[model samples]
Target: MAAGGVSPGGPLGAYVPGTSLLHRCPPGPKLLGLLVALTLAIRWPEYVAVPAVALFALARVPPRMALAQLRPLWLFLAVAFGFQVLAAGLGTAIEVVGGILLAVALASLVTLTTRVSAMLDALVVAARPLRRLGIDPDRVALLFALAIRSIPLITEIVRNVREAQCARGAGNNPIALAIPTMIRTLRAADALGEALIARGIDD
Candidate 1:
């Protein structure tokens, strides 16, 4: 997606415009809150995961939609938590997974409520002090925006690739799926690079 163009929301995990309190909240505060929530989740007691789950509730996104954002991670989470269980124990595993999920949910909430431009502006403002280090805040902010915006685009691409493969009865073939997905992803990246260069952002 271009910096100025408004892309449609993604399947399942895209932002839904709303007038709720979380939707009205400023991106800066929401970002700070996410950081704090993540920190607490990582370092605090198991009970802390409770309120972390509550944070998603405060975001007011539908339960099904929120689950959609998380469903993709289940396989990864399962493997990771399984390791924790073997190395530590069930209780420790639960705490770790719960904390991680809470953190992810909080981040998803921020993305859902905040606009891409608003997020970039917030990042630029936060990066102002880094000027002493010879960093370009605008460039850094643009990079951040591109990274966030690409998530939905990439998700959509994968969905399309999977559906295409399934329609051809090749869905079970990893090679078929991986090859096209990689080719498409690289093509998209090359086009994005060309667009950036054309706009005089070659650096």
Candidate 2:
């Protein structure tokens, strides 16, 4: 509904807002950190060696803000914890949860600090190094914007459709929900394509 906005799960997934030190880091390194954290997260022992002091540092971030960003993934984290505890034990469960959360915390820091426009600029700059692959910088930027913004927008549409369906007591039928959901999704896509063309995305 607004320009320079966010999407729910795609590129705009889990945007955290803040003006912390972590926010000003360059996009390349910030993205690199996410990659490293993800690798460490899959191994619980990695969580323990992360240095208590660093964990404490992350703790300094506003809990309410972090919690809000983490909310979307809470169910998945809980499920992973449950699985680890059942399949492994309390120790493993704690390890998995800590590792995953550590990654989340770092990512949250990046998002909270960086504005969407800044992120787009960074991505465009980073992709400049990829022009050797016949990629257009403008197109790449548009792609990033669309992918990221689509997340929040799609989530919004889905939420609206779901609520309307449930209000009519049709929430139980998967087919009913899927049909309308798909239709709405297609409509959104068409609208986006038209908007992009209008903005000269194809030319």
Candidate 3:
């Protein structure tokens, strides 16, 4: 991607700015919506998941773009569905996968609509009550922010690693990709930890 260019159909959690109703909503409400969507998706029938997934897409961007966000997981989802079908039945597989996809979609919506700073602020505020129990809200909020921000970084690392492997004619080798990816991920984590310590934020 070019400087400041939007990545084409990045997986969920990549925020896209928009002028939709969801974008206008506060983070707290959006978080609540995510919770509600997840609850309904998990506790209700499999069919309910379809709408949940759709709503997540429609709220963020066009349906096509939303689907693109999920493209990366298509293989995993397919494998999971296949396993479920073999273990149980087609209907059960559909239900299980649908529910998972729905949850993923709803979560993507939350991150897409809400800015990272706003998310951290909301988390800090929400965690205030826990401060009485000796929990540091700021630390908790930082952890959440790190987790969200790390998703895209990790994705990029994987993409770069795959490309490097492909250049060396190892593109089709899963082991070749996995080994380097794991090593790079660990190095990245170590670097991140070192940076945090340097900034005196490792607490």
Measured by lDDT, the strongest candidate is 1
lDDT of 3 by residue, 46-133 (tens): 6566676566656757677667668899999999999999999999898888877777777877777776667768778999999899
TM-score for model 1?
A: 0.60
Q: Note the residue pairs that clash in candidate 1.
A: none
lDDT, candidate 2, 33-77, per-residue tens = 767765765554365345432643553556676678778889998
Report, for all candidates in order, the number of backbone clashes.
0, 9, 0
Candidate 2 local Cα displacement, residue 94, angstroms: 2.3
Ranking by lDDT: 1, 3, 2
For lDDT, candidate 1 versus 2, the one ahead is 1
The TM-score obtained by model 3 is: 0.58
CA-lDDT, candidates in order:
0.79, 0.71, 0.78
| Weakest lDDT window of 10 consecutive positions for candidate 1 | 4-13
In order of TM-score, best first, we have: 1, 2, 3
Backbone clash tally for model 3? 0
- Candidate 3 residue 139 Cα shift, in angstroms, is 6.1
